[model samples]
Target: MSNVTSGDRRVRRHLTAEIKSSLRDLRNQLSMLNRQVGIQLDLKDIDMDCLDLISRHGPLSPSTLARRAGLHPATVTGILDRLERAGWIARERDPADRRAVTVRALPDRGKEVYRLFSGMNSAMDSICADYDEEQLKLLADFLRKSTDAGLTATRDLSASGA
Candidate 1:
């Protein structure tokens, strides 16, 4: 019932492969960048990720952080311990929920971490400037879809004990 031909299918497959390859490269590069930033800050990769999450999402409970970071609650506790000790994050008692504590990134420390990526941010801005609004919208949509796919894959793998 479809008019799609073999050549069209092959082209689509090739483009998909290219996209996957680029995503892999981008992930690897980001991991390397995170490691470099961690070393510069004398923090572990997970610590950096935790700080980033708090910086982006504001205060979050430990359980919420664990879910967001794809980490076990025990592991998140350890990360929080380190971040707290380093003055990168602070735990505050939730006013409405006395029993729950939320983690927040220290403003100065968050700015310090972001300083490391300032150049990359500028470069990304320049790259975006090369595209027109319509093209940029398409790119944004693709990235959002890709991120959702990645999150789903992560959940599936975790559930499967992989």
Candidate 2:
């Protein structure tokens, strides 16, 4: 009843396997790079991760930041305090409600982080040079979808019995 030819199925399976392997390699390499960056910044790995999320997501409440980082609110508080002291983030009152707090990334003071990541950024740019606009769009689409899938898996994992 299947319309797919055996040869076509074989090629698809091969490509799928290769994509999975490449994803694993990319994850490991990025993890190592993040660890190195954390070390250089003298920050805990989780703190670095939280700061990254804050920077990318712009202003966020402490609770929202905790959820995004998959950390406890108390733990995020400590991370925020440390980051605040380090001049990496600012914690302030929300204008809409004085009871609520907002956390903002102080990117101007994060020049060193940018400097440290410049090499990797340049390398990525060089790699992207080989791709045409359409290919780049396709690559971006794949990465975005893959990221969404990973996030979904993470959310669903809590319901699964280990």
Model 2 misplacement above 4 A: 1-3
lDDT of 2 by residue, 41-158 (tens): 8988888899999899969999999999877899999999999998899998988899999999997867888998999999999999999999999999999999999988987885
Candidate 1 lDDT by residue in tens digits, 34-140: 89989989999988888889889978999999999999999999999999999999999999989989999999887877899898889999999999999999999
Alpha-carbon lDDT, every model: 0.93, 0.91
* Least well predicted 10-residue stretch by lDDT in candidate 1: 108-117
RMSD of each: 1.2, 1.5
**Reference-based TM-score, model 2:** 0.93
Candidate 1 Cα outliers beyond 4 Å, as residue runs: none
RMSD in Å for candidate 2, one decimal? 1.5
